[model samples]
Each structure stands twice: as structure tokens, then as C-alpha cells.
Target: MNISVIGCGYVGTTTALMFCELGYQVVAVEKDSKKLAMLQQGKLPFHEPGIDSLLIKHLHRGSLVFTGDIEEGIAHSKIIYITVGTPSLPDGSSDLSFIEEVSRQIGAAQNDYKAVVIKSTVPLGTVDKVREWIGKAQKRPLPVDLVVNPEFLREGSALYDTMHPDRIVIGSDNPEAAETVKQLFHSMSCPIIVTDCNTAQLIKYTANAFLATKISFINEIGRVCDAYGANIEEVASGVGLDHRIGPHFLRAGIGWGGSCFPKDIAALINMGNNNGINLLIVQSAQQVNQDQIGYFIDRLEGELHGLNNKTVSIYGISFKPETDDIRESPALKVIAEVQRRGGTVAAYDPMVFDKHPELKLPGVRVARNMEDAWKGSDCFFLITEWDQFSKIDWGQVMQEMRTPLVLDGRNVLDARKLRSLGFRYYGIGRKTGIIHE
Candidate 1:
């Protein structure tokens, strides 16, 4: 089978490569010329582990190809996947202009039966809007089936998540169309859910909202633990052992941030508001996440006496490890807050700095290396927990810093070990008392 993926962003690129891995020829479409050139060369425009290698393999085998022309992509396959971005508008509603434009293009270029699959995360009832847009754009009457196949891939581990999804959801009013899409994933050993378009869209939003809630819930608990001198890790471990909780999204940290969670939660909240239903739990989750950043900064400020004239060494800039996606990243928020308090910022990331050498953060000193981030700094703040951070020489860090203050935002550092090195250590809900000194 041939598949056309429109848009070459992380989700689009990953989806195209996934189809190629499934033995289907894929033609990926991207309007951005730079991204198109990168894709043509088997180079990813963004940082994602394991995707680059798959892209190279597929291009070599003639299974995957890149194109900037939407008409060409639409004509290349009967199954057209709309994986374009539906970024959040200022009003918290999903801006579906991209989806709408793509739909119109597909419709305008359609000459035969086409199964249009929506792989992008969209608001509920968007499938209906897409159907309308596509119908109106067609030069004449043409058979087109719309399918809502929401993606559930994580950023850092996108390829693994795509190749090994927990479930496959095919949403369409037409059972035949749904079944046809379902057969495309017959080799994958996972439950395939066939449902209406609305339900599938809701499932995507609800899944991200619930995960955001879990993160906020645990972070709120972490605040309580901090006040009572309790161990949050132990608390989470005990709570997760109950099988009902299942130990995922239970890790408490600076809080959840990424492309999906914040936007989805906001859109879900906006959905509830438009329907006269106040989603209080989700609203609180959003609030708690925002406040968690302030709470961490407050601790840092109090420990330093004041941030004015202080230098803060930020260990990680990207939201999380193994990816360079900084959209809604908590680290950026932390950087902004630190600067607001008059602190000078020095930042380092294993991937972000190297991948985006031209990347500039206002008022941030980009460190050449991890050691450069902490040198002459007052506090070593670990925001994103890259694996390399876990193996850092804390003793050496203590010696190099003007003041040996360690704030482990992700709580991946050893509190005891840092304290033994004569550095003051603080982790969210972890023991702050000096263990060795």
C-alpha cells in the first residue's frame, strides 16, 4: 500500500517512516523548503533518537520519498495522512488553519477515491470540519473517506513508541474505511480500536489531560512532602505499587512540559468552557504546574539570599532528555523566572546546543560544555535530566562553583553525595538536610 504523509515535523516524519517500516511506500509532504531539503537528504529537521537511521534506511530502499508539492503527495497514494500541526491559538482553541488548508488541497487535487487519515491531534468535531473543507474544495463530486487515527507517540522515544504503540485507534463513520485503515497495522501486536471520529479525538485529548493531571497531582504531593520532610520517591513507589496507579507519570519533578500536554490540557479546558462545563480538575492541574516553577525558584532565591548579581548554572535547556523540543519547556520558564529575579543565566544541554548552534536565548549564556555551565556559578540547577547529568563529577562541580549550591529540579542527582562533597543540595520533596557534613 502507498501512504502520503503531509507535513514533515516530528509527528509527520515519524509517521512516514513508520509506514515505510510497515512495507508501505510513503511520500512525505512539507511546505517548508528548509525542512523539505533536510528530509530529502535523510536528515531530520529536529532532534529525535532512532528516526534519522530509519529515514536513511527507507530512503536507500526507495520506500520513502520527500516532496514539497501537496498535489504530488496526494496523487502518490490513495491513503493520505494529514499529520500537519494544529497549534493552539491564543484563546486556547486549536488553530485548525493548517488542517483546513491541507484538506482543501487534498480535495482540490482529488480525482479518485481517497481515504484521508488525520494523524494530527485536533479538537473534537474537527473531523467534521475537515470533511466539509475537503468536500467544498473538490472541483467535482469525489468519494473521500475521513479517518481519525490519533497518534500516541512520545518525543524522546518517538520511533520506539510508533513501532510499538500501546493501541491503534481507527475512527471513521464508515466501517469499511475504518477496517481498511485497520488492516494496514495488522502485523502490530496491539489492540486496534474502531470507533467514531468524535470518540477517537476525545480519546487523544483525554489521554494527554489525564497524564498532565497525574504529573500535577504528584508535584502537588511533592510540595506537601517538602513541607513535612517526607521522601516523595518512596511515596510514589508505594502509591504506584497499587497496580491501579501503575507507576507511570508518577515521577515528580519541575512539572510536565512538552508540545502535547500543555496544549491538549488547555484545549480540553477550553472545550469544557465552551460547553458551559468548568473542568476544575484540569484547571487545577494547569495551575499547579505553573506554580511548581515558582515554588522551585522561591527555594533557590531564599537559599541564595537574593538572585541579584548571582549566576545560575542551568544544566539542561530542552524540556526533557533525548530530544531538543523546547516548546512549553519548564526549563525555559525557569530561565525566565531566574532572569526576572536579576540572576545571570548560563545554560547547557547535550543536544540543544549542538543541534541548534544558532539557537539564541535572550539574556542566556549558552555554555560550550556541561562544565562551562557551572564554572563561576552560584547555583547548579539541573532542569532536564539527561543521562549524562547522572554521571557528572559532583566533587569537581563543587570545587569549580563560586558557591556549591545544587538544585536538582528533576531530582535525578544524589542529595547525599552532593552534600558529602561540601555542596548544599536541594531536590523537590527530597531531604534538604546535610547528610554527610
Candidate 2:
């Protein structure tokens, strides 16, 4: 089968490559000329592990191609997946202008039956809007069916998630069209959930919202554990052993931040408010997540008495590891707080610092290397859970810092061992062990 994946963003590019890997010819469309040029050369515009290699491999095999022309892509395939970005508007609703424009273009170019599958995360009733837009643009009635097929790809491991998804969701009003969509995922070993468009949309939003709630729920519990000098990891492990509430999203730290959770939760809250219903739990989740950096900053201040001229180093910048994307990263919030308190902040990340120079906030120095960041710092905060950070020399870190205070924001450190090495250690939601001199 031939497939055209419109908008060569993270979701679009990965989906296009996955289609190519499935023995289908794929035409990847991108409006950005620079991104189109990069894709043509089998290079990714953004940082996603394992995708660029596949892109190059498929490009060599002639299974994948990149183009800037949407009409060409639409004409080449019967199944066109609109994987464009639906970025959040200021009002917390998704700005679907890109999707709308693509729909009109597809409508104008379609001469035969076309299945317009939506792989982008959109608000409820967006599939209807796409159908309406396409219907209005077409010269005559055409057999165009819209499918709501939201993506569940995590950033760092997007390709893996795409190739090895746990479940495949096919949403459409037309059973035949939905079944056709199901055929696209025939190679994957996962249960197919065939549902209406609205249910599928709700499933996407509800899934993210519930996951956000779990994060906030545990962080709130972490705060309680901290106050009582309890171990949150132990508490979370005990709770997760129930089998009913499996051990996922239970890791407590500086709270969740990424392209998906923050915006999705905000959009859901806005959706709730529009319908005259207040989503109190979701609202609290947002509040708790926002307050997390402040909580960490407060803990730092309490430990050091003041951050006024202290040299504080941060160990990670990306929201999570294996990707250079710093969008809505908690590390940024931490840097800003440290700067606000007049502390000099030095940051080092394996994948972020050089890839994204824009993260160089005022008063925050993006360090040249790990040693440069640690040198002469009073304290260090581990915000992102990168594997390199887990393997850092703690004894060397103690020697590098003047005060030897460590704040483990992601809880990816050995607290007792750090204290035994004469470094004061603080892990989120865990009891602070004493630093013996």
C-alpha cells in the first residue's frame, strides 16, 4: 500500500518511516523548505534516536521519499495520514489551522476514494471539522473518510513505540474504513480497538490526563513522605505491588514536563471549563506540577540558608533523556528559580546544551562539559534521568564542589552513599540523610 504522511514533524516523520518499514511506499510532505532539504538528505530536522538511521536506510532502498508538494503526496496515495502538529493556542485549545489547510489541499487534489487518517493529537470533534472543511473544498462529493488515529509515541523512544505499540486504535464512523485502517497495523501484535471517532478522541485525552494525574498524585504523596521523613520510593513500590495499580508513572521527582503532558492536560482543563464542568483533579495536577520547581528551590534555600551568591550546577537540561528537546523542560524552571535567587547556575546535558543553544538563559551558564559544570559549585541538581548521570563519579563530584550538597531531582542517585562520602544529599520525597564530616 502507498502512504503519504503530511507534515514531517516528530510524529509525521516517524509514522512515515514506520510505513516504509512495513513494506509500503511512503511520501513524506513538509512545508518547511529547510526541513524538506534535510529529509531529502535522510537527515532528521529534530533529535529522535533510531529514526535518522531508518530514514537513511529506507531512502537508500527507494522505499521512502520526501517532498514539499502536498498535492503530489495526496495524488500518490489512497491512504494519507495527516500527522501535522496541533500546537496549543493561547486559550489552551489546539490551533488546527495546519490540519485545516492540509484538508483543503487534500480535498482539491482527491479524484478518487481517499482515507484521510488523523495521526495528530486533536480535540474532540476535530475529525468532523476536517470532513466539513474537505467537503466544502471539493468540487463534487467524493468518497473521503476521516479516521481519528491518534499517536502514542514518546519522544525519546518514538521509533520503538511506533514499531512496538501495545495497542492499535482505529476510530471511524465507517466500519469498513476503520477495518481498512486496522489492516495498516497488521504486522504489529496488539489488540485493535475499533471505536467511534469521539470515543477514540476521549481515549487519547483521558489517557494523558490520567497519566498526568498519576504523576501529580505521587508527587503529592512524595511531599507527605518528605514531611514525615519517609522513603517515597518504598511507599510507591508498596502501592504499585498491588497489581491493580502497576508500577508506572510512580517515580516522584521534579514533576512531569514534555511536549505532551503539559499541553494535553491544559487542553483537557480548557475543554472541561468550556463544557461547564470543572476538572478539579486535573487542575490540581497542573498546580502541583507548576509548584514542584518552587518546592525544589525552597528546599535548596533551606539547606544553604540562601542562594544569594552560591554557585549551583545542574546536571541535565532536556525534559527527559535520549532527546535534545527542551520544550517545557523542568530544568529550565529550575535554572530560572536559581537565577532569581541570585545564584550562578551552570548546566550540562549530554544531548541538549550544544544541540539547543537557546537554553542559555540569562545568569545561567551552559557549561562546556560535566567537569566544567561541577567545578567549584556549591551544590548540584540532577533534573533529567540520563544514564550518564547515573554513572557519574560521586567521589569526584564531592571533590569538585565546595559545599558538596547534592539535590537529586529525578531520584537517580545513591543518597546513603553520597552522605557516607561526606556530601549532603536530598532526593525528592525521601528522608535527607546526614552528611558526616
Candidate topping lDDT: 1
Candidate 2 lDDT by residue in tens digits, 235-343: 9999999999999999999999888898888888888999998999999999999998898899899888899889899988889898888878999889888888878
RMSD of each: 1.1, 1.7
Across residues 1-437, which tens digit of lDDT does each residue of candidate 1 receive? Answer: 89999998999999999999999999999999988999899889899988989989999999999999999999998999999988889988989999999999999999899999999999888888999999999999999999999999999999999999999988999999999999999999999999999999889989999999999999999988888888999999999999989898899889988889999999999999999999999999999999999999999999999999999999888888999988889999999999999999999998887787677799999988999989999999999999999899877887899988888898888887788778888888886543344
Residue 114 in candidate 2 has what lDDT? 97
TM-score of each: 0.98, 0.96
Candidate 1 stretches with Cα past 4 Å from truth are 433-437
lDDT (Cα atoms) of all candidates against the true structure: 0.92, 0.88
Q: Candidate 1: what lDDT?
A: 0.92
The runs of at least 3 residues in candidate 2 whose Cα sits more than 4 Å from the true structure, single-residue gaps closed, are 357-360, 433-437
How many collisions per candidate? 0, 0
Task: Estimate the overall C-alpha local distance difference test score of candidate 2.
Answer: 0.88
Clashing pairs in 1: none
